[model samples]
Target: MLTAPVRTMILMVRHAEVHNPKDIVYGRLPGFGLSPRGEIQAERVARFLSARNADVIYTSPLLRARQTASVIAGQSNTATVRRSKSLIEVLTGYQGSPNSILVGGFSFYTPVKREGDESMDDVLRRMTNFLSLVIKRHAGEEVIAVSHADPIAILRLGLEGKPLTVENLHSVVYPERVSINQIVLGPDHVPQLTYFDVVRSMETAA
Candidate 1:
């Protein structure tokens, strides 16, 4: 029998690279799955989390994030994989555009907010709300959440007491495709970031 602990452990993982051959912005678009290399990255993460005895996994409904969560669920001790809209990618108006638009700061610099866009505050609220429910429902259990970079970064910023702004969002070193952020919540239900690192493949001794 597994015993619960005094604090809950949450692993926030960014989904692996997508199979976007055209290099276009796929913001919240359907049908974008993981690339071949991304599959390898997911496997590496699975091994890492399996070692930690992760109890369950919650993932964004997007294909890429769901695919990554599937790999982890299969390899880890995780009993179930649940879908949560709170972990979905940020809603952007740049979907289907060239990736350069985002890289060039054109999107963020735009003076007017688009109809379907999600502000930093929106992201923070949903992420924190999801977190509160998770902490209440699974206190002291190890859990994994597979999501996109912006949502994970925003959540991290809020938890770390940083300003939730686009400037900080871009400036913060978001988790890589093969990385995970570890957040620990104690009896008081306060989230604290312990570490975030790339899940490099395990090394073997010669």
Candidate 2:
């Protein structure tokens, strides 16, 4: 049992590198796994989190994210990682096209077109709703959320009440391997970022 006001700590992490040779913006593209380097980075992230006391683990429904979460879970001996649709990467309007949306712009209103896709606003709303549910369900608990870059960035911006503009979106950079963002729940039940982009340092034994 726990007493006193408890703060829910959420560590939002970007998934490791993907297996995209041309690096064609494979937003929400299926059948893409992590590269070898990505696997190594995932292992590093796992090692970093294995020492912490995480109560729950949440991951995006994407393969890259699921693979990364699995690595961490294996290291921490945690079973049953939860999958959520809200954590999926941003749904770009253009799919299988070379002309993609520019990175680091935060314009959720700008409508891009893929054959069949949702708008940026729609994606943001769904992500926000999903985050709210997660926070309510896991209040005062330390959890790990492994998601893609765009969704993670959007979620953080939404929590801060910032407009999902292109500039603001472009400002978010995916941290190096095993970087952690510590979000502490305040008394008002709002999640605040205490630490952002703290990359775990390599161990140097004496």
Candidate 3:
């Protein structure tokens, strides 16, 4: 029997810019929140998704992701932000450093097998697993998941069946672009991305 197409809009929102005046790597470092401009960007995202009628907002426990989710939910006057462990930042081998050359290494096949780090495939697994639960929870509804750049990129690449390299992380959405990725889930519990977008702005991100 031919099955009908099921639509579940999952707006993948990258957290707003951070308050890093010193320009530290700040990769998963605790206590970093949105910058002044980032707050503006969060407002823009909240406004952008205002029409989404979001059922529930999911966010990483990280301050930035949680802040973004709260702004969207507060502005939309709906959906209280929920801390989802699956939506948390990807664990990396590297902790904190200025040099980006040999920082946290990302993998697509095997787990990085380092201290507190995850492979790209691991990220893909958790991200997809989280999405599956969201689809099941809000079948036929729009939901928002706010997370970091690399994790979001991993999920997008995996959904398209594309391999991930260090460079592939560039395919992620910019901060506050309010990218809406419409995901369709099959009965077999697989999420197929039918639409993906990032609202690029000509002006500098505010």
**Top candidate by TM-score:** 1
Cα deviation of 127 in candidate 3 (Å)? 0.3
Q: Distance from true position, residue 124, model 1, in Å?
A: 0.6
The TM-score measured for candidate 3 stands at 0.79
List runs of model 3 lying over 4 Å from the truth: 1-5, 99-113, 170-180, 186-206
Steric collisions counted per model? 0, 11, 1
lDDT of 3: 0.70
TM-score of each: 0.89, 0.81, 0.79
Point out the worst 10-residue segment of candidate 3 by lDDT. Answer: 194-203
* Candidate scoring better on TM-score of 2 and 3: 2
Q: Which of the two, 1 or 2, has more TM-score?
A: 1
lDDT for each residue of candidate 3 in 1-206, tens digit (9 for 90 to 100): 11114666677788887887666557678988999888877887777778778888889999988888888888776676778888777776454644344445534224453755787777888988888787677777778888876677778777766677656655543233345555555455456564333345424453
Residue-by-residue lDDT tens digits, candidate 2, 61-109: 9999899999988988653599988888777655455534444553433
Question: Least accurate stretch of 10 residues (summed lDDT) in model 1?
Answer: 197-206
Name the 10 consecutive residues with the lowest summed lDDT in model 2: 197-206
